[model samples]
Target: MRLSTILRGGIVVACTAFASGTALAEDLAFTLKNATGVAVTEFYLSPSNVNNWEENLLGNDTLSAGDSIQVTVADGRATCVYDIKTVFKDGSNVDDRAINLCELGSYTVHE
Candidate 1:
């Protein structure tokens, strides 16, 4: 009986750790830019990882010309998908020019 209990407990702990590791797990930085040469009162940055978009980086709703907003993800992951947008400045859109500051980090699990 004691052995069975120990085994069950061990399995539960392992599963819990795995589940927690995958929950909202990601890491990256985002920056928004204004390519319209105008002040964007509302701006946003949408970022996503391999198969998750909702959990990605979502930016604010406002930004000025030449101004940018930044956020860092903590899971230490990189995403190739991102969007920069103008939230509510009239004559603006979700499209904007951007310069990637640095390459995304590599996955530790793959290597």
Candidate 2:
């Protein structure tokens, strides 16, 4: 299915009919878009109040520029606010703080 994208700023949240089909507590999933013109070697989302980065969401997969992936929070953390961290293949990293994952349908990361 083709999902509509939300373009606001560096961190965007889409509001489409497909996105509202899931329940927040049962399915904490969101789309992650890569637009940094680089391969994302790692992706992480940690609770806003947490001090350390969570496990790599991408695992062994790499997200190239213009690509997107579905990220699901199955660890049982129900917090809407999170800090995102993306590590590029060139050993570079970018961090976006205090993003509401619950309200976010799709998050597009831009350079």
Candidate 3:
């Protein structure tokens, strides 16, 4: 009986470990494209539930029209849903919310 119990316990532990590993491995990554007529001057991504916006993901670089950039979502405390903000060279901006980064492979900005 003890041997059988040990075997069942091992199986449970293995299954739990595998489940957690799979969740961690499912990291989110995608591409952001500037399809608008003007250049994109800024980009920001934040958790959908948060009020404070994070830093500019683009840093010092600008995304010109028809260009694209890869974005890897790695926020330690982030959820699957995110908010995307983009600013254009003309100072126009867009703020979109409830985007599922886990399921999104690409996002395009248009005028």
Q: Rate the local accuracy (lDDT) of all candidates.
A: 0.37, 0.72, 0.69
Best by TM-score: 2
Which residue segments of model 3 deviate by more than 4 Å?
A: 1-26
Look at candidate 1 and tell me the lDDT of residue 75.
Answer: 40
Relative to the unseen true structure, what is the Cα RMSD of model 3? 14.7
lDDT of 3 by residue, 1-111 (tens): 001100000112347557777433334567777888898887887778879787877766678888777666554443678888999989999988888867768888876
Model 2 C-alpha lDDT per residue in residues 1-111, reported as the tens digit of each score = 222432221222335324876443444678888877888887788888989986777766688888887776655445778899989988988899999978878788876
Over the stretch 1-111, how does candidate 1's per-residue lDDT look in tens digits? 001100000112346557777543344544444444555553333453223223212233334454444444444334445444444455534443332424532111000
Cα lDDT, model 1, residue 33: 40
Clashing pairs in 3: none
Best by lDDT: 2
Q: What order do you get sorting by lDDT, best first? A: 2, 3, 1
Q: Each model's RMSD to truth, in Å?
A: 15.5, 9.9, 14.7
Model 2 TM-score relative to the real fold: 0.74
lDDT score, candidate 1, position 43: 32
Model 1: lowest-lDDT 10 consecutive positions: 1-10
Give the Å error, residue 48, model 3: 0.6
